[model samples]
Structures are given as structure tokens and as C-alpha cells.
Target: MQLTVPDFVGFVGVALVVGTYFLSQMGRMDVRKPLYPGLNGIGAILILYSLSNTFNAASFVIEVFWLVISAAGLIRALLLKSR
Candidate 1:
């Protein structure tokens, strides 16, 4: 599958955002304070949005998996906070 300009941009943007988070978590960069499960939820949304623009089935499936896992993490965080 050929990558359209929009698809490439979206894919790269999502990767950058996620990579930033990873770098921050690993102490490789000090971009911002950890947002805990906040970024997890937001990143999942961004991933799904990017997937919407991608033509690759593998990318779509990976994003769907991330979406589900992030949603679960968010829910768990919320429940723990409420308790």
C-alpha cells in the first residue's frame, strides 16, 4: 500500500508524540512532567485518528490494539483514583 502524504504525516506525528512520551519516561529527555494515564488516553485517541487516515491494514490493527489497551489503562487509573 502506497503512503499518501496525509497518511505519512499522520503516522509520523503519532510516532513523534509516542516517542516523546517514551523518551520522557526513560529519563532520556525532560519534556514535561509525567501525566500518568492521561497521555495514555490521549495518545490512544491520536493513534485512532491517525489510523483513520492510513491505508495500511497492519497500521490500523496496531492502532486498534493500542486503543483498547490504553482505554483499559485509563479505566484502571480512574477506578484506582476513585477508591
Candidate 2:
């Protein structure tokens, strides 16, 4: 199969998510930091964009929830920082 732009974008999203997890696992990044959820949210959005073209119901649902959860995490982090 040939690679497309959307595919590349999805791959980049995957890389961001995996990279964040790797960093956290290695103690290089904190999961509570804004960057973690930011990366996850961006990654989820990218995946959703790719899914819009491919149209997978399950993947779309999961990505939507993932983005929502990431947003919540980011919001929580910001609120905590402000306090």
C-alpha cells in the first residue's frame, strides 16, 4: 500500500503519543505536566483528522474520548498551577 499525507499525519500522532509514554516511563517527563496532555490531545486530534478520511467508527470513538480526557488533564493541570 502507498503512504498518503493523512497516513503520515497519523504516524506523527502515534509518534507523539508513544514518545510521551516513553519519556514518562524513563522518568524524563512528568505525566502531570501540561506537555503530556498537550501532546496526547494533539495526537488524538491528528488521528481524528486521519480517521475523517478513512472513516473508522471505533477508532473515531476512541480518539474522541482520548482527546476529551487529555483536555481534562490539561485543564486540571492548569487549574492546579494557578492555585
lDDT of each: 0.63, 0.90
The TM-score, computed over Cα atoms with residue i paired to residue i, of candidate 1 is: 0.58
Residues 18-78, model 2: lDDT tens digits: 8998999999999888999999999999998888668899999998999999999999988
Count of backbone clashes for each model? 0, 0
Writing each residue's lDDT as its tens digit, candidate 1 over 1-83 gives: 88766666566658655776787779985533234445655665665666666557887787677667656766776776677
Q: TM-score winner among the candidates?
A: 2
